[model samples]
Target: MASETIVPPTVGDQADCNEVNTCHVDEFLYDVEEVEKLAKKGKLKRQYCLDCNSRNITAYYFSNAGTIIGVEMNKECCEVQEKIINQYSMNQNRIKVIHSDVMDRSDIVASSNIIVANVLDFFVDIEKHKKIWYFFKQHIKKGSYLICNRSITDTLESIGLSEELIDWLSICKPCRQENEIFFDLEDFMDMHLYKVN
Candidate 1:
């Protein structure tokens, strides 16, 4: 199989996708690395992406991942992801890019072993944010890993961030796995590895 260097979207590629799905190459790579470590430990069998916008991550997983599902609500992003899949001749049976809201796909969310949910704050409103988080808290099966850029805990007061959601986290009591690699993104990104209870 031909391997292309994992490159971030260029100016032209950015135009192809929605503004919400901006090309954050370094952050995307960090998300991939965090999951890759778990995959190496045999902890990841089926992986899911909440806001999958990276072609590189998709390519890497399809090479050896057990089951990879990228749930992208953005139609344009899905098209870009699908093009990469088609170009690589990846096995569609193992890897799928479902163009739909993550909340609409409960079965996928419930069955995922590792879910990489990048910042979902861009797309949904305050109410929808609460609803989606509630859906995730309820659906994501126990023992599954939830990797998100934002803190699930209420470290600060922000719109759409609900106490009920944080309450659920406290109720479930998920263990936060730490990373040795530290990022200096000015606290713009906080990587939390939650092993669901």
Candidate 2:
């Protein structure tokens, strides 16, 4: 399937993502159906989705297939989030938003099937990044996935973290595949998929 053809968002501009303090979900043009197709085809990884049998690792941490914990540093966009949560009320329990730092949420790390940490560069600092990685290493179970918008190396470098001292390789490994996984939906075009090693 062609990756670039996305349904434009009804509200706001995708280019303004960097300028805003908090980006609304509808800011970027994301075709949910296309994204699902990509996930099933093994070309991309989708969060809170269990029907993608093509995935190498089955996220076994969650009891219910639709249960997802959405962790955020701030409550800047509560209204938008509420709208998103309401959209998922039909088939399963909607997303549960945890208003706190990701590192502090040990309960979340322990139970979530796939932790989608999008735009971590905006919220996490250097020291927190190190602490969070260590925390994740200690907590997140094997076989579960971590989907992030920024590269692990880039996140470290952005925080002035020295890779020699802190070895993230021991904790998690990148999802090994023949071709790169690209999510063509909205702000997720450059996202990478990783697994707990």
Candidate 3:
């Protein structure tokens, strides 16, 4: 008799649309005008946002039927996501929001062009930081960009985490001038961008 075969699900297969449809989450993040704008610009593709920024314009491109792979979206970050989505109503099909825990999900690869990890410091322990870095390294295509943010208090709270973890998140504190609201030197918030090569 032949043995039964068991196969693990692929990244595409593991994502269950029935559990949380994109539209439900979309409604929470976007409005009519914003959606229309995105459609008009033909910028709707794959875009990610950690902390909202005017420079995060890749979202406009991805939202309009462009191919956007991964987005590090949290329930609290939905507002910014909606604002970007609302810019393009016709291209909503280009977007997919994965509601999984960013730190723990192994399915996410480095194939994404834009990786945004906003306020992620709040959720992870120090030991897991290297895994996070390696995870990003694995999935991002060469020359792809990674965006990350961390709050000071968020970092302090992360002290309970491992030393390696703190080093990973604290590598680059974004200049306050670049990000007025989210990047404050004294406040313990930092944003970084990395190009995968």
Candidate 4:
């Protein structure tokens, strides 16, 4: 969101995106109930969704007190999402579909009161994913929330995760680390919600 092209070269530009649409499932619905619970506690505001789809866009449209910025790297994804939003007439000034790498938009990330990253495993490789975590740690404002569907403890071939990042954000729900998503009743993945320290 800040001026100029200071995007990290991974999902930063079109080339790195491989011109291949990395759009995946719209599984944010699974978290909608939990998010609504959190919002009822008056915890949500200015949320950002990374590599997001339309489901969460509608889910978050209610927070008139906040803004929703959906960041996607694929042009087609953004176009499709914009069309969907327009069709729903979510024509509010608070919603934005940004066509750039989430890493490139530090200003947007920093300002967000909460972040929803469905999953980064499908979008980038392990190394790039690690870098993105580092970038998030660098920019996300303290006290903000980071809601991701992957474990921060998940590591590469012997690449240790930084204790600093772990120490910086404590999981809002310890049980989330154990909670698994069932795709056809099979364990798919774990989900986590964190509050930055």
Candidate 5:
């Protein structure tokens, strides 16, 4: 039997969509050393995230995804992944890029071992947020993880969604498993890691 060759993800020409998924790695700063320090202590596995504008985080993840494959979803016209696909031609197969909304894709969520979303609050409304939570509960497999910028507890409390949020997080128990490493980026934002129960 022959080993299959990995190909980079397919990307669109632009990233503009009715809604743009941007993980503002800069807006909410974090300490890189701290995240890496944590990541070194735990298991690092296949991961997924979306709306990789500017190709900054995508490139960063691209480097890491070499050993552990990841799936990145962006708008149909996303160029960040396209640029990365062109620059690191060899890594194209490591990270699969899909053009779709994070809320709309439960399949990807089911496959990923870890999912990270920065500035998730900025992307959708309260209703959409609920739907997102539903996706997390319904699709994210047990033992998988979720990393995000805002506190799910706080967000739920502020939005009067504590009950629902609690139910979901109870299964996706709040956890701190791995260190998140970002190139030149600090883990300034109080990002939380949750493990699905």
Candidate 6:
């Protein structure tokens, strides 16, 4: 069988349909499908630990997938999440979802094999960065991973992250508010994070 071209949804595309805050069923499915493909292609290696089992040492996703917990609360996004879950529930039994403020959920953190935050920098405040770091340190087990992506701005200093962290975390600049390929330093700050034990 030929592999399907899975075009993951963009943040702006969802925003346009007024589905940004709602459940993004399509996007969730795309993520699930993409993850599954990666695993099948040997792009994602299986991982195991005392807390959880994950097929991939590093996973990719959006902010909504991380934050929104309940299907009912995130109607649009959950629809997609549920569809994807149901489709691969058997093969992806270990994957689970927890909904809570990233700043507050120790249980979620403790249980997570890999934690992902998309566009998280927008939500972080300089004053609260330390607290957030402390939270991650407390809950994340050694050898686990943290993957995060965020837009770059002057607030980087406020986030208390070193330049090395920024370089290691960021993956690619997808786009800008102006709907153009991100090119400038201001645009270049979009980052991705991977937690290393």
User: Largest lDDT belongs to which candidate?
Assistant: 4
- Give the per-residue lDDT of model 4 (tens digit) for 1-197: 23434433475455443212332213455376766665444454323355652224334343545679998999999999998777557755778899999999999999999998767777788788788888988999999988777765553222456564668777775443255532332243476768989
Assess every candidate by TM-score: 0.55, 0.51, 0.39, 0.57, 0.53, 0.38
What's the residue-level lDDT of 50 in candidate 5?
A: 54
Q: lDDT per residue, candidate 2, 1-197, as tens digits? A: 34444453545865433312222233255577766666566555444233643434433333446666677766876555766555433322455667888778898798877877666555666677667777877888877777777776676676666464245433343443667553335555566666766
Q: Which ten residues in a row have the lowest lDDT in candidate 1?
A: 167-176
Report the lDDT tens digits of candidate 3 across residue range 26-129: 54556877766664676442243437423334423413324554445466565466556675452456665555566455455444556666554455655565
Please list the residue runs of candidate 6 whose C-alpha ends up more than 4 Å from where it truly belongs after superposition.
1-76, 87-93, 128-130, 150-158, 161-197
lDDT score, candidate 5: 0.58
* Cα lDDT computed for each candidate against the true fold: 0.67, 0.60, 0.50, 0.68, 0.58, 0.50
Off by over 4 Å in 1: 1-64, 154-157, 160-162, 167-189
Clashes of each: 0, 0, 32, 0, 18, 10
Residue 5 of candidate 4: its Cα lDDT? 40
- Deviation in angstroms for 59 in model 6? 16
- Enumerate residue pairs that collide in model 6: 23-76, 23-77, 24-76, 24-77, 25-80, 146-195, 152-189, 152-190, 169-192, 170-192
1-197: candidate 5 lDDT, tens digit per residue: 13644333346653332223322222245476645554344332123345543223323543444433334444544567666566545455565567677766777778877877655567678888777777778888878777767777887776677886575554233434479534333444476667777
List the lowest-lDDT window of 10 residues for candidate 3: 16-25
Give the root-mean-square deviation of each candidate in angstroms.
Answer: 15.3, 14.4, 20.1, 20.1, 18.5, 16.2
Compute the lDDT for candidate 6.
Answer: 0.50
Q: Give the TM-score of candidate 3.
A: 0.39
lDDT of 4 at 166: 66
* Tens digit of per-residue lDDT, candidate 1, span 1-197: 13535444558745554434433334555588876675555454333344763323433441345889999999999999998788657888988999999988999999888888877667877778777777888999878877777776642136545554554443223333485333444553457666777
